[model samples]
Target: MYYNCGVGGYISGIAKDKKTKLTTAMATIGGAGLDWHDVKSYLRPNGLLSYSTLNDGSNKLIFNNYPGGKVFDAVVLQDNSQGPIHPELKKFFEKYAAIHSKDIRATGAEPVFLMTWAYADRPEMTKQLADATIKVANDNKAMVIPVGLAFANALKDRPDLKMTVADNRHPTAAGSYLEGAVIYAALTHSSPEGANFLGGCEKPLAQKDAQFLQSIAWKTVKDFYGWK
Candidate 1:
């Protein structure tokens, strides 16, 4: 289960196409301003691991409408970009995260939190969001993907990289690719440094740039988890 906004959509796009160590079957339900509250509405009434589709013509990827009573191994939860950091929304973010973590555990699936990046223009948000996300994940004893940390590391290493669209919030192709790579590294506990998936970017990334993003992703994940 992958649920959130455009970031989750882009990650699902990579999972749908990328050939990695893990064979993934992802169901992505996304829309703008999608928070945990919105996710709660879509939870299966039967208390299954599946969710009803919220197809408002905004979702980039929608797969496996019904899990057919099949349980998911893990469910990725991403709140709105500001949900973790915003004062008013942060409470709901924490509350629903706890609720959903327990709900997901009840379904025999681990709850994984997707730590999203801050808006491109607001670089300071990186640490703020990371802190908030880590707190919640620690509270639930859940896994944190650390995608936000990957984004911050990428920008710090290469300030010239165009990570976001003109809106400075939505990710560009390169940014999306980085997100996927970080996720891959975190989930598989392996480096994505040499995998040849370009994340379906409109224009293929240069080999050098792709490798750079992959390295950054692997490094970030390794550091976040204190992995060797």
Candidate 2:
């Protein structure tokens, strides 16, 4: 099974980009519960499958929401935090280990990947999040992906590259393209095809023509999944 889950606010951006048509069927499907633990009983009996989501926040937020649940895998994340790892976060993961230990003893094996996506406030901040993420992942034996750092590397040379700033933080059209690449990278563990996706949005300076950003956007997703 393929389970998609995340906080409502984070998934809204993806729905807007991937299925802009608000009335479409997809608008309602393909996401997991924001608080996975809260819905554990509903998910446990379902069995093994692929999972994805932007379920990032305080560990307590996750713990309170999820109690003794297991995922085949996960990409836990939090938005921008300018400082070093928040003390609360460290505490939460420690507690997560305790809860997970109990769950693992009962349930066998499950994989977890701790992730974070946020623009760093300064150059050194990336290192801080990296170190913190590594430490937590080590303690919990979870995979770690520092998406914000990855974006910084991807965009370093392309100064023109920028996230679409709608209400200031949410991705714009171009921003969504960047986000797609990030997600692609997270899934594939590779430098995903980034430029190809952005090409669809270029404004035609000449003849009267039509362009559809969604086509490129969707292709990016398809190609990343090796579906086309």
Candidate 3:
């Protein structure tokens, strides 16, 4: 079920790179929901299948069974919480962890938790978020992809990169690329320094900035997994 899981962050980046020459549907379709309830629904019966938008800007979000049930290798779960560490973050993670163990595991699929970043300006929240993520992973015995710490580490030496958007909450193009690199290292346990990528971005990223992001991602992964 590659659709629902596995390889954490790098799947899209690597998948896209592998098919760079392909035309049309070479992109990975990202499926997500408004909140935990919405996100969890996708794993159940009558979940999201597909949708479309018209030239008139009309669109619909459909929910139904996708083809080839229970065929995915693993299911990757992530908390979509925004802003500086929320007060109820722990509860939120615990609930997701429970869902992964009960529902995902029932399908013989391994659950993965994608540790995400905090708002760039709220630097202090990064460690807290990472800690909470680790706790959830340990509790559920799931793998934790520490992309947040990678972002924080890169910011220490490269704040000018402006990884997040103007609101400092969402990731910019370069930011998402760096995240994919971090996920690649976590999954492959191999250095991403040699990999050149500008993931899912329209405008070209500077070579120097891209290289630095890759290096930082590699460093963070190695440290997090004690890969020394």
Candidate 4:
């Protein structure tokens, strides 16, 4: 199950680049503006199979009322863009993350957190979100996909790249591509440097840009986990 806000959908196309077989049963409304608390409500014990279709800006799949008795290898969880760092919402983020982790474990699946980036104009939000997410992930013994760190790293290297749209919160196609790369690395522990998925951008990403993002994503993941 991919429980998300907006960015989680991008993983489908990116996963395809790495030749990762990913089948997502997404629980979200319109694919945006949802917090961890809202996700917990949708995943209540009695409504485990209740999910909506997911349009990852590439493919759209409808899995509502997904067939019962199915098991997933991992479930990715992403909170609202600011839930992890906002003063008022931080507590709820921690609380629901723990709750969701326990519930996901009970189903015998690993719970992976998708660490999100900050608003485009707020560069500092990257570290704040990462710190909060890492703390909770450690507490729950869950894995964290460090997309936020990758975003910061990429911007630090190439400040010219536009990672967000006009709203400064939602991801642009390039940002989404970077996210997909990070998720691929985190899940497989392999570099996405040579994969061919250019993402679902209206105009496919230039090979050089894609390669750069892939490199940044892999490096950030390795650094975050201290992997050689």
Candidate 5:
């Protein structure tokens, strides 16, 4: 599996076999301060990766937004946030998740919940995020992709690597790799143990570290699914 993200890494293509190329379709519109409802607006098709907002002016918009009725194999939802587990935000999350989950299921597609990592500074949020995600996902009957667990497991061993960037919330390149790997393994049910695809962070992640994260992702996903 390869994790390639024009906007976000659906994944950087890491193939156990070097000769093959994996193609994926992903559209993202997010950053800090964006919620699941904000992202759900971009769920339309035609690869309109970005709608070309201000601040990032140099990026030329390539794909036009397609009309509605587009179908996806699975709809994975995530929000890059810090206080989402707060009492107020938790209610909002539940509301939006219900809306999006029902919409995805209505389209005959699987609804996947992306469990993102909380800041190491606010370690308490880790469990809160996981628990909240599981609760909401279960209520909606959506599969939970435990990327947060992969990050937690990876950091326990590879303390030298920075999962969050300088902001203490955003993910660094290695963090993104871990997220992608965990998502890939969860969705595919295959081990990333030997996959060499480093997504877009070859420099940030050395060969050994990349492989280490891959193993963690595989284990986390397998464990979450109760695989023997």
Candidate 6:
């Protein structure tokens, strides 16, 4: 039931808490750039709560749209300058988890899992970031949802599905949907009808898009759990 307390509020209204059966525990990544202040606003006055990636670093990375470095081989800054594996990033996610934990506990709901999706320029860098990111999540014993692999897979076939106008790295509306699909699948433990639901959710992406997304998503999930 945790959320990013930003655009994630939009996802609050999908279907009453029948499946999850609980009010959401919201969390914002970096606690910045949120369109709304709290779950109430993010979910809108009328929307019921489900889940969304309002504040995870992966989503923040997507929002920042930081390009991958040529030498680093990753999109996000993972060097010592950024304090790779330092307390700052850990603290950021820690504070995030603490807040959501408090919120969920107060609401008497059991914490489920956490979702993240980052866009890096290369596979090697993505693995590095994923390693560090996974460490942080595992240290806290929270389920970490991998959305990057999903994004990468979603684009395998649809080479035209660029997230940014020039970079093809940041997530576009379609990319966001791909992220949502991954998170949705994790929370529900059931796959959606389509891998990447585009066209205002009325029509699924072409078969190529679905396969591409599915390909990466499956791999990401596999890596997350060491399914291989």
Return the top candidate by lDDT.
Answer: 4
Q: How do the residues 1-228 of candidate 4 rate in per-residue lDDT, one tens digit apiece?
A: 121233445566666766778755566543343342454444543455444446577556554543343356687888778887778877877887888887777666788988999888888898898898899889889999999999889989988988888989877778888887888788878888887767663546888898899899999999999999
Note the Cα lDDT for every prediction shown: 0.72, 0.38, 0.62, 0.75, 0.68, 0.42
Worst 10 residues of 3 by lDDT: 20-29
Ranking of all candidate structures by their TM-score, best first: 4, 5, 1, 3, 6, 2
TM-score of every model versus the real structure: 0.77, 0.47, 0.72, 0.80, 0.78, 0.52
| Highest-scoring model, TM-score | 4
lDDT of 5 by residue, 1-228 (tens): 122233134253653333324334554445522243444454555323324333377665554453454545677777556434776667777777888887676656677888878787876677888988898899999899998878788888888888887778777777777877787777667777776665563444688887888889888888889996
Q: Which stretches of candidate 6 lie over 4 Å from their true place?
A: 1-90, 110-125, 155-160, 165-169, 193-204, 226-228
List model 6 lDDT by residue over 1-228, tens digit each.
112222232122221222333223334434241122242223222232322355656763222221231111101111221122345555554444544434434443333333333334554444554565566556545566766556545556556676433443444545654554555555555444432333233433466654455455555666656665
Better of 3 and 5 by TM-score: 5
Rank list by lDDT: 4, 1, 5, 3, 6, 2
Residue pairs with backbone atoms closer than 3 Å in model 3 (clashes) = 1-71, 1-72, 1-73, 47-64
Q: Which residue pairs collide in model 2, if any?
A: 4-31, 4-32, 5-32, 37-66, 38-65, 56-77, 164-172
Mark the regions of model 5 whose C-alpha exceeds 4 Å error after superposition. Answer: 1-12, 15-23, 31-70, 201-204
Please, what are the lDDT tens digits per residue for candidate 2 over residues 209-228?
00122233334345433553
Candidate 4 residue runs with Cα over 4 Å from true position = 1-10, 30-70, 201-203
Candidate 5 TM-score over all chains jointly: 0.78
